[model samples]
Target: MELLSALFLVILTFLVVTAFYHKHLMAEIPPGFIQRKKLCFYHYLLNFGFVLAKTSEKLGLASEIHVIRTIMNTVPPLKDKHLFIKDVRFEKIKVRIYQPKIPTTGQRRGVLYFHGGVGQFGSIRAYERTCCYYARKSDSVIVSVGYRLAPEYPYPTQFEDCLAATIHFMRTAEDYGVDPTRVITCGDSSGGTLAAAVAQAMVNRKDLPKLRAQILIYPFLQAVDFNLPSYQQNKTFPILTREQILLLGLKYLNKDVTLLNVLFEGAHIPEDFQLKYQKWLSPDNIPEEFKPRGYKPGKIIHPLSDELHALTMPTFDPVFSPLIAEDTVIAQLPEAFILTCEFDVLRDDGLLYKKRLEDHGIRVTWCHLEQGFHGIVFLAPLGRIVSFQSGNKGIKQIIDFLKSI
Candidate 1:
């Protein structure tokens, strides 16, 4: 009877979560819904409290990526110091720099920041506060790369742009009061993905100074298996979802939408490829403990389709999945400061990458937030919405790691 009651509660919570997500899911929200914009912000901010008070139980958070984005957009921009924002065209690529006036002793470390939005719909604006805070806290020079986005500037372009900007900075670090030797490459979300990829690429370039460190805040690492423990358990998580992930994959590659069905069936990756990469992407790679909440290895698809396999080629390329880089390259990487959230679908990506880094003798400083969800880092103290403690803690954790080095 007790077991039955627990199962019922889980089922009920899932029902509510799914219903809420679907309400905001329909490709994009219609403009008619804009009339309720104010209400929506309050609803999301007070959602957990609302569920607690009314249901006498905690309501699972909904994973509405665009909805959260829309709500965040509605907030009046917090007053920031007058930033002389300029887009400097650096040898064909463009980059935006943010600096606070305070001279450094020797040269300070230069941060090549990559913004995250699944390689789409994100810009320097999304991470305004973050860049500001880092500048004020670390007293370092911060350059936020507004790399090209998907469906607008497709695969390889964004990565190439980030690489170009980073290399240009390393060459001209002296002009910006930055030490070439102490530079860092960092980013969040898909930005974190870009940071890691750029870091690996830097390792191969003997022309550049070695990176001081790489800070990856819950980066999305692999695309081989969307059925990992984290994906299955947090399949419907807000801010990011399994369905939305596939959508972004298509958008990034400019792939045909008609193959979406086969893509979802694990058909995008062929049998031999799956077998070869499963060691790295498998749920088995994740520990048994992470499965406590809920996790089940998905059913295998014997025959995958060729049409589904085309554009997805970039998914496993070292440029996209730095975690898939060769061991020799991984070993040479700077020490890592990694942050992972228990409720995020990309949690396992971080975990697997952490393990690989450790296996390669790379020192890793890891901070895992058990109760936090994805995108909490971007929501610090902005009214009725309370910041996730882990987000702030995660930020401090990375700062601490950077300071230690």
Candidate 2:
């Protein structure tokens, strides 16, 4: 009788979980998505895992779900016969270096990559396949910086670690057979944030070799206004949602999650500050084609609390939000390669930055992946099960850009 009772309970629990998934998640798929059975199953599993992570956090049994989600994506490194991989420490930060084993005439271009997890979870191991791809395909030396994550190190720590590692690599490029003048900084998601910010921070440094370019892949450039069109259109989108973005931001800042709604309402930023930065961050900067999906203009919200102001002010700084850097800085920034995905919540961030770069007379190569979503690039060639065809196209575009510059 007890065995029969246990079997019945397990079946009932499975049915309940299936019902919840189909009801809440299956209904939220955005229009024009590739409706493959595998794709839907992948998203369903991810949503189910997120739900478990959320329950763990609420029960005080684990860290933030954002970090957990990133951790879940970690996989063992694949063996690359053409690349010589090594792990090293620059100051206190860890980094993985991938060098092509094949012969070259002289020094190769160096790529300094910062992996993205909203500053909390990614590791050098997590980005091994990505760095390997670039090192092998582009024939460049890749240095994947393993910066300290948040909820422990907090804001500015991740930046400092990345900057230190970048400086170390730039200064020691010759030892690694890397051309000092051809080194470029590259990153995706929040790592793109670090790459952009680090590149800007290096502009005035006379000692280090100048960076040849910066490659930003669907970076989250600003936290000042979350009501941008991409945010609205992809609010309920999978993998990275509007709520998850704010949640990750709060986790990075080690701030209260209660501010998510207020920040979404644009209450944290002062009206005057918003007006000042609107020229670059406004919906007007985004091309009209990107808006056919959906977008509503954001209204100014009065400053709410001084506490919220103090907590969120770091986002206004150039180091934190490179998108708001002054015109002069934008003019001096390295030639840029930016990739934006149509279904990404941070798509407009790339669009706005592209406009700013062009306005400053900077050379820009922009690639838009219409069928791609945020984090798709990282899935390239992994498999049709986890990888999108658009991801392969995006990787090819990046490799071509690297070859050009």
Candidate 3:
């Protein structure tokens, strides 16, 4: 009885400390955020899980990524009778395929989806319902690519896996009753970065059928300037913060997290490269309406140090920063559907990419969610209690675009 009492006391103390930390986090949520109550609950749960995972990592019971991935992937596979789901490998890459059960008079459109976890911790299992919904609602064959993650697979492997899976799907799409010519590439967050790179890479492929469209949802397009208007406005917003983005990105590249400060300050960018990409990445490319939140041209605090520039050279590669791709490449890409959340740090990336595509004579369908935030669309599949109306609306916009093309 005494031991039980002592254990209970410890647990109570932990809970109190956690609650205090959570309160501090809650204070950072913006005033105009949608569904404040639900957001608070979600944030608390996420924060608690993260704390537990970190504790476990320290105790050597499990790594933090393993614990978080296990928790996120814990949702039981949906037993939806309306769709046929299968887990398969494409060119050694894991992927989940979702197809509607209903018979189709003609070949269905194909969609290759890449799940987002900053190239670290998302899986097809975590996004099961998302792909299922798209397949059923749009009557399309959805392939959710479970690309290899960072630290384990390292940088560019995720991009390579996504590109390989896309090529495999495009080649064998007929076997799955999908229209090869009507294939689309789509992803959110880091996944969006892959989709954009894959589409750009495919532009030069003379063999495979051209992609019908590319959809990027709140994608991180560049590492050039982190002080864009949206970045300033929503840097502290929930789900994803500016510091977290830089830290995760550094980890994804297998670089020292210590470089985050230099990267954030734009010291990792070379003067020559900055000059060449300025026209595409300039804040002036962003429209006036987006600046209403707050934006000031960032003054260069320091020149690029050769050591720092060398460490961040990969960030300038087109495969990593699709926004910096040449105009010739941009013009040859397929029509794009870019989604930007008003309260997302990466919002300007989408807006700038949209403008670049348009300037290059490529068609772009842009969706701006004023009340939405990063990772909102993923919540739509979690049910009414956790999902927001804005997320459902975003999903609807994606479905509508799929059907139109």
Error of 3 at 349 (Å): 0.9
Ranking by TM-score: 3, 2, 1
Clashing pairs in 2: none
lDDT over C-alpha atoms for residue 230 of model 3:
88
Per-residue lDDT of model 3, residues 337-405, tens digit only? 999998799999999999999998889998898888899999887789778989888999999999998
Clashes of each: 1, 0, 0
User: TM-scores, in order shown?
Assistant: 0.79, 0.94, 0.95
Total colliding residue pairs, candidate 3: 0
**lDDT tens digits, residues 71-173, model 2?**
5556767689999999889889888899999999998999999998898787887778888999999999999998987767879899999899989988899
| Residue 217 lDDT, candidate 2, scale 0-100 | 95
**Candidate 2, residue 291: lDDT:** 87
How far out, in Å, is residue 65 in model 1? 13
User: Which parts of model 3 have CA positions greater than 4 angstroms off?
Assistant: 1-23
Candidate 2 error regions (>4 Å)? 57-70
Residue 248 lDDT (model 2): 80
